[model samples]
Target: MTHRPLPRPLNFAAVFLAAALTVELLDELVDGATGAAWPLVRQDLSLSYVELGLLLGLPGILVNLVEPFLGLLADLGYRRALILGGGVLFAASLALFAVAGGFWPLLAALVLFYPASGAFVSLTQAALMDAEPARREQNMASWALAGSVGNVVGPLLIGLAVTLGLGWRAVFALLAVSTVVALIGVRKSPSLSQEAPTGEKLDWRDAARGVVAALRRGEVRASLALLECANLTGDVFRSFVALYFVDAVGATPAAAGLAVAVLTGVGLVGDVLVLPLLERVPGVRYLRASAWVTAIVFPAFLLIPHLGAKLALLGLLGMLNSGWYAVLQARLYASLPERSGTVMALGSVAGMVSGAVLLGLGAIAQHFGVEAALWLLLAGPLALLVGLPRRASLGSR
Candidate 1:
């Protein structure tokens, strides 16, 4: 029998993915600009490193804490409403940050902002998975590339704002506008509920059961652990890389901006290439090899002596690190076919926990030195390589 491909209109998935990326980019811009504002904020508000970590890491924690509930909501045919509400809340949070002048207000705003961002990310992934069937790998690659593009644009946009003599408050205003645009795009998106399974009310108990089920399966547990480790390492690097360049490597903020641009730009290339390569290599082999390579190449940052060399090394690291999320996400989505929404939500929880731990490590590094912290970061990939599943299948349960 001849099979016909599913109807996918006007690349709606791509458009939806792009809108999601814009929100992510705006969030990143806020994150980068706030991090840059730390020196000024520290002197003015008497902020300590612990407080800084709290401001930066708290959003992620809140997001992780709420992800499971949000995912379950999406599975119960509430995907569109959840995304719309999340977008509105995210924009409102950014707007609040625009005028928030002191420490407490900013911290409170982040608690709201992070969960909103988490809802957008988790729901968007679920929507894309629901939208595409046969081209899952390709669609996952596209989704990842959208995020990589956001990462590249976020720091660059912040650098431009800094160059224009815009205050940090102005950056938050700009992010608010971006979120509003994303909200509009999301509203125009087709309802994912049309494609979802019917008559199945998600059980609240399944959220806990999903966690227990994932842990009991060795392959699923291994993949989740690897993601947590990699995410922790990446978050720590992101948090400290700009500071390290300025204080340790003797570069200005603009120069640090350029290095970040290069790092994330190369990562975009890695993300774009993964889908095509997936056709040639099995998922497990590709993941195992990528993990090994990243482990070997990531620590090479310590060997580079000059600013240019360090920037180049960061770009190389970006290429290896960028594809990790897509590969891992594809695997997880495949592993829990009937419950992808739940599984993805749990992954977000893991990322949140890992981010909190990494933020603490980042604070320690800030007080001591980045070089001293590199040793601990090196352990992440090594642990992944050791714990990685040996199975060869892409989505084998």
Candidate 2:
């Protein structure tokens, strides 16, 4: 007997991954730079860390708020337009960032940039998942690998930019160019074909009812809750690790950036190595194990005083945590296969929790110290434990 092939197999995975990879690189590239170069940006503008926290956190507020509407669009099967349009908007915002000279101006630029960036990222992944519903885990593993590349390259870019006096704004120009190229590839790709209608058009009355219903589902609540918890640690690590290295570890700005590179760069190994290793294992199992390992390892990472030891431990941390993104995301996408955008929007909402936590951490650091705040990141993995094997399987509802 002959077996049938996948429906025309758009085979857009390569183009989709390429476009997603470029944006992933740009996102982390700019963000990593922002974290490392904040001292300079803050000093030049005479802003406080509290203000820095606000700057980092507030723009994301609007982004998260808009995510559901964008999800509505995603459910409408407009992934192509969202992907390309969001990218151009983000690049434009980056250009504005290059010229902004003050706090309010920088804030305005980021308002446009962050939400656009969110669309570029979350929607693109939705589109990718749409393209290969069956191979989502593998595709997402590849996607995570690309993001891991950005994680490493982002800090290194910041380090090189600072060391060479190219300035943080200079990196934005390069990213803007890259974003356009990614869009070009997206325009040519076949990844955004509509498979089916996910939900009705966004009528607030209807949407409110639908959202309440989705939130009530066991799979939705468990998966999203655990994910939000896991990301709490992630938010801290992403936003503050470099600063911790600089302020607490007493490393130079450049060295701190390199240290962050070590943390994220080694994650490449995790994404790559875990793909095949966990192929037979369920996504839920991998996620719970990763959460446990991260919780166990973090305190040791903090207590160690030697820079070399911390870096080595960070490498280990990166490896273990690397597969978590893909695996967790696959679980979420599988849980609600049709509502890709809506589910993703809910995930983006989960990320808004970070802004609040980050603000609180900033306050804690301001009063107590940055080191004290870094300790708060352990909440991420500990959260994973609470939701752990009360764990949501795809069919766990």
Candidate 3:
């Protein structure tokens, strides 16, 4: 007898994914605007590189500390309030961000905005994973794809902001408006408990033990290390690329915006292309090979003196870098399939160190150049080469 495929379930997986994507798109637009307008912001505020890095990073400390707790709460079934309430707060924060005029207010806004949005990011991933466990890899890829779409809109939004004389604040304003609409849909949607019903109440003791246990797993260790490396490199690039375009290459702000757009736009394509291969190929192989390729292309991208040449190389680099997260994150979930909530919070924990990295990069840029600071990104591939498991499958275990 021939095997017949089971029918796909009618659930809010699609709805939740849409809400998640909307949040991502809105967040990236602001991110793109900030990066694209960095030089302008810097000049306007008469800020130093150290100040800028601190401005961008110091507010993240509180968020990082509470992240695991938030994850644990989500695992305990707070997805509805976390998603809906957090999104509205996230939107309000963005709207507040528009009115922030000086360094302190700006810092406050970052503090409020990141954690607020962090809620959406962490919970949505948990909910979506809960909603469809079997399709973890595909769902992770879809998540990235959605973020990539946001990435594209980000620079384009900034580019339009510059063209229309709307200024950087406009990006935040638009994101706030868009986020309100997204939250409305999110609020109306069925609770995640409807699919993955509430579990036992969160036990901090159990969570602490689970974390210790997770840390001991060689697979978890490897994946988290790779994630840390990936986050560093990607963060450095995102924070610096627009500055590189305008500061080093003398590109216009609009041109810088487009350059960021191109970098992420190519990444979007790469993510879409890999969704199918993810099922057929060993994720580690792709992750490893992509790492080597990105490492190779990255320096050449720096060496090339021409602005156009660098942009072309960045697109190639974007394509290579795009595969790291999907495959690595999939492998991550596969490592401890039950702890999607935990995996969502690991980045924030790792992010605790990123401020220091950004500070060092800022120092380097102040003393030498942004390109010299960017050289630090080599740590990403180096970590992959040493830490990522050599197993034939996605997870070494």
lDDT of each: 0.69, 0.74, 0.73
For residues 138-229, write the lDDT of model 3, one tens digit per residue: 77777888777776667667778878998877877878898888778667656444222244555667666666787789888787778768
Q: Which stretches of candidate 1 lie over 4 Å from their true place?
A: 1-12, 37-54, 162-166, 194-198, 240-262, 272-283, 299-311, 356-372, 383-392, 395-397
lDDT of 1 by residue, 1-397 (tens): 9977554554665576566556555655665566556665566678888988788767665667687777777666677787788888888888887787677887887888877876765676676666665445666666677656655565556567668887556777878887888778778878445323545565667556666776688767766877777764565566667777877788899998787667667777887777678767665667678778877777777667777778888887777776566666677677666566677567776766675676678777878887677657777778767766677555522
**Residue 137 shift from truth in candidate 1, angstroms:** 3.7
Q: Would you estimate the TM-scores of all the predictions? A: 0.79, 0.81, 0.80
Q: Point out the worst 10-residue segment of candidate 2 by lDDT.
A: 388-397
Stretches of candidate 2 exceeding 4 Å from the true structure: 1-10, 37-54, 101-105, 158-167, 193-205, 238-259, 302-308, 361-379, 390-392, 395-397
Report the error of model 3 at residue 250, Å.
Answer: 8.9
Comparison by lDDT, 1 against 2, better one: 2
Candidate whose TM-score is highest: 2
The C-alpha RMSD of each candidate to the native structure, in angstroms, is: 4.6, 4.3, 4.7
Q: Report the number of clashing residue pairs per model.
A: 0, 0, 0
Ranking by lDDT: 2, 3, 1
lDDT, candidate 2, at 341: 75
